[model samples]
Target: MWSYITSIFGYFFKLQEDEGREKLLIEELIDLKLELEREEFHNQNIENKVQESSQQSECFQRTGFVTHCGESYILIDGSFYFDTSACSFNLNVNDKILYLGYNNSNEELVIVRILQNEGIGWENEDDSEEQRFDVINHIIVGIVDCREDRNVFIQGGDLKFNLDDVQGTFIPIAGDWLEMQCSIQKNDEKLTDINMTQVLQVTHFRPLRTKIKSGTVTEWSGKVGIIDNQIYFDSSTFIETFIPQVGAKIKYLRLIFNAMGLPQPKIGTVEEFQGQERPIILITTVRSTESLIQQDIKYTLGFVNSPKRLNVAITRAQISMILFCNPHLLSTDSLWNEVIMNAVNNNRYMGCYFPIEEK
Candidate 1:
């Protein structure tokens, strides 16, 4: 009888334990259902916000010539300036293009796509007649005037030529002096029109030089001397320690080469120089800021962390290549670190003494 009583108490204890487990399981199921509902509510809110934002933004398409193409913005029709950071293709001045644009919630103009680019070139597809023309090389000086219609006019004395008549990749702003080589069209040995075939030089200031003999100088005052009433010379005229204050290195190089009457080297982006080989190539990796390095690595901005782009950029030179970059920033990536190590092992690495600041 005692054993039976003990067994009954044991059975009752087991039943209570099973009931406790079931209650705990039901509570856990309720908590899980609540979490799922919360997650679904959060997703629905995000979808609603996205739909509303899409409705608020306005999108449109337009056709116009690019009047000004800057580093981050492109001016179309001489009025609207759109952000070009998202554009895949490079834009140039006076390019007839069709683009898709939209205004964001902040009312900022954004460029979505570049549909077409009919660049300014002297080629007629409809004209099939082979007209023979002589190539007469002559230099002419003029002042540039950019018009609202995306037309660049060069006016000097009584001469004026349209933008289509000029041939060069350089686009000058208004009031700048342009020295170009052109061919005056001749019909039957008589000049019919003055048309510019090529642009050789462009400058902002007019070049003036005066020559004087030493014997022609009559009087001298302090550091200034007047010679033959035509020219004056001072201590500043002779450069003791010449240092050019230039904002851009490439432009300064171009100016130096043009002054010496030498052929200018081609300067273009990596994408533009693809499939083209050069004897000497200089690559400028413009990212040097410590703060931006992390962002660049995360997004693969530029050649950093991008193996294919880095390979293409480094292999373009057949003879020699000079790469300018910050080793401290680029060494964060394995690929770039390998390149740096290779250069150091080859004894070809040259480092700057001072810190490189972001430009």
Candidate 2:
């Protein structure tokens, strides 16, 4: 009986040891869970701080106009010149822009983006007047209708304007595509009227027989001409090519035509040609280097990577659109790749390889 009692005491001691071990394990698990919670809270705080910093940076953006554009620098508001090394796109004088920099330091200024080209704003001569009128300029495209002597009109998509209200030297011709630069008058922030300042271009309407053509950069000679009522592209022709190295693309085209003794045709940037249609449009994708592929994709600045810009550039033509680009470089972007594939499927793609294959 005494031996039986000693065995029972030994069993009790073993039970107590097991309970102690379980308690210690529970405490350790609680501590680990608390540490995990603290870590998550710390990470969330860091993210919040980063977001706050980004918001503060955006708040510092300022508005200004480019008064002069040089090779290495651009003058803003005719007061300060900023370095252009960081700029991704070409800048021209009279471009209203938004910028980021310290108001007190001209050296720290950088242009962020262009607001508009050739912006015009006028207020009353009296500085203390509470009322104001704002004039904004726009480039518009529409189809002309000369059905009635007093009701001559131009209609484009959903917008229509009476030609009688517009002041320009253009004599309205029926079935012509009209592109005009006009001014919108706004009084107290309300749109009052639109007036055509100049007739930029006019193209006669033709029956839609669309043809797409693409060529390699090596084969681009900028030669364009018309034969038998159809436009032709030849690399060895005497007519000057429209190459936009700086300033406006239309300006370059005009200069080339003047040099070749041909009347200048209407040519403008994709941005300028929005809401406009033409019988023929030629687009040049200027980015060709392999080294710039990743950089251009990251920034979405040029034709190779900017899908929206490519869409705008290709869709502006109603009859024929000629595209000149390096096929290898354009294939790096998905949208551009689709464009090449579409052309290839239609048997419209024309490619040429470099004399020496690039490494």
- Most lDDT-accurate candidate: 1
lDDT of 1 by residue, 1-359 (tens): 99999999999998999999999999999999998797667544543443343433334455667888888888877787766644555788877776655554588665545656767522233322223333222334455655435345554222334455434434567766654433322233422123332221111122211111122443355455433321223433324443222121111223223322334577766877778899999998888888887677688776677887788888899999988998877766678777777777777889854223321
lDDT of 1 at 265: 70
For each candidate in the order shown, give its overall lDDT on alpha carbons: 0.53, 0.49
Error of 1 at 351 (Å): 1.7
Off by over 4 Å in 2: 1-253, 259-262, 353-359
Note the residue pairs that clash in candidate 2: none
Query: Total backbone clashes of model 1?
Result: 0
